[model samples]
Target: MGQKINPLGFRLGTTQSHHSFWFAKPKDFPAELQEDERIRDSIKNYVQKNLMKVSSDFEGIIRIEIHKYKELNTTQVKIDFGRQNLLTREEEEEKDDKEEKKKLELLKTKAKIIIQLIPEPYEEPHILAEYIALQLKNRIPLGKAMQKVIELMEETDIKGIRIQIAGCIGGKERAHVQWIREGRLPLQTIRAKIKYCSYKVQTPHGVLGIKIWMFVDFVDEEFVDFVDEEFVDEEFVDEE
Candidate 1:
């Protein structure tokens, strides 16, 4: 079984060594910086600069990545935060587990200040993630919760979003899977370009595994046309 969910608001409580995120979409970036790669670099630089300014003691590496979606009009920015200089395993082991955990939590909280550097439009995903975390705090039915998430994303520029939750749901003994999606289904393919995020939300019943898949957009119309043509050809062959 998965570890129990961290306490509420414990976004950084997991054993993850790094926290990374991709801005949902580009909004209002300068014309020259509109490209996904450029936007990713700009956001990474902006975040690093802002964090450095606030925390002179902070010294970490930030990596920026831009994933091309489909033919290139759609792009996703991925940013990774490295835990360099945070602490060594030896040093961490020297402290009590609880004390070390608290220290790490504080460090993460300080690191999270970088969230404020994100601008509007692009910040929608972050807000949506927070919303999901908050809404799952209570014992709402899994289907209902996923439906609510779909409703929330329908209003955004997200071309496609999928949410999957697994675990002892509704206080049942047998673990189950529940999921929902809005817009295009996130297909696994070279052209689909899906970015993912995972979180563990603790509930009255047990820890619910939350997985989010964000897609650049629907599959190309050309692909859809090809699929239809193949279907028609197969139907014709069957009629023979």
Candidate 2:
């Protein structure tokens, strides 16, 4: 009277009802998009990143297909759980269909995706970007700007920093890029917490891209604290 369970713990012959599905079927979504082969890779990548909680699920590979139609240029997405044996219909399951429908009704309310559009309200980059923007508005020379920014960042707990600016600087026609840094380079170093931000500076010369990196290891003993050298006194008399 009991059903068999698959190796993955999924109950065999249990029909996965549309009502109990993961993704919500939007009204404008085209049902035929499920069958389209062209956009399969795109849909798979998007779903793998945004949906499917388990990384192990990627090994089995969730199949997703998308189709675009010219009638108002709408897009439809289809998802396949990619479990092959479960695809076949079993006659015994048909007898339990009514019972399954009743169970689905109980579970349908729980099936939903809660997406957090703004996960972090106060990110560090916002503050850093604003500081740099305020500094660049002075129309100072590239080297002077870099030095001033480094001086400003020294007051903070940042371990290391780098700033790079490119394009025709100081009203010159030729384009060039130069970078300045204090302490270790954040990107190249291994096992260091690093924060990165970039901003564009529009000036009379040309547009300049400003990249900032703030290394976050404040209490790191290697950089800030050190051991003093041992001093010894030797007896000297003959020479005197």
Best by TM-score: 1
Instruction: List per-prediction Cα lDDT, in the order shown.
Output: 0.46, 0.42
- TM-score of candidate 1 versus the correct structure, residues matched by position: 0.42
Q: Which ten residues in a row have the lowest lDDT in candidate 2?
A: 228-237
Q: What lDDT tens digits, residue by residue, belong to model 2 across residues 6-65? A: 211221122111211123257634543332332444434543453334332321223232
Stretches of candidate 1 off by over 4 Å are 1-116, 120-129, 218-240
Model 1: lowest-lDDT 10 consecutive positions: 108-117
List model 1 lDDT by residue over 1-240, tens digit each: 766442112222221112222233345343324443444444445434554565432323233433322322233233334433333465333322433243234322111111112222221333344446556675455667667777766766677887777888778899999877777843534345444556666777788788776665533432222122221223323332
lDDT of model 2 at position 32: 34
Instruction: For candidate 2, report its TM-score.
Output: 0.38
Candidate 2 achieves a global lDDT of 0.42
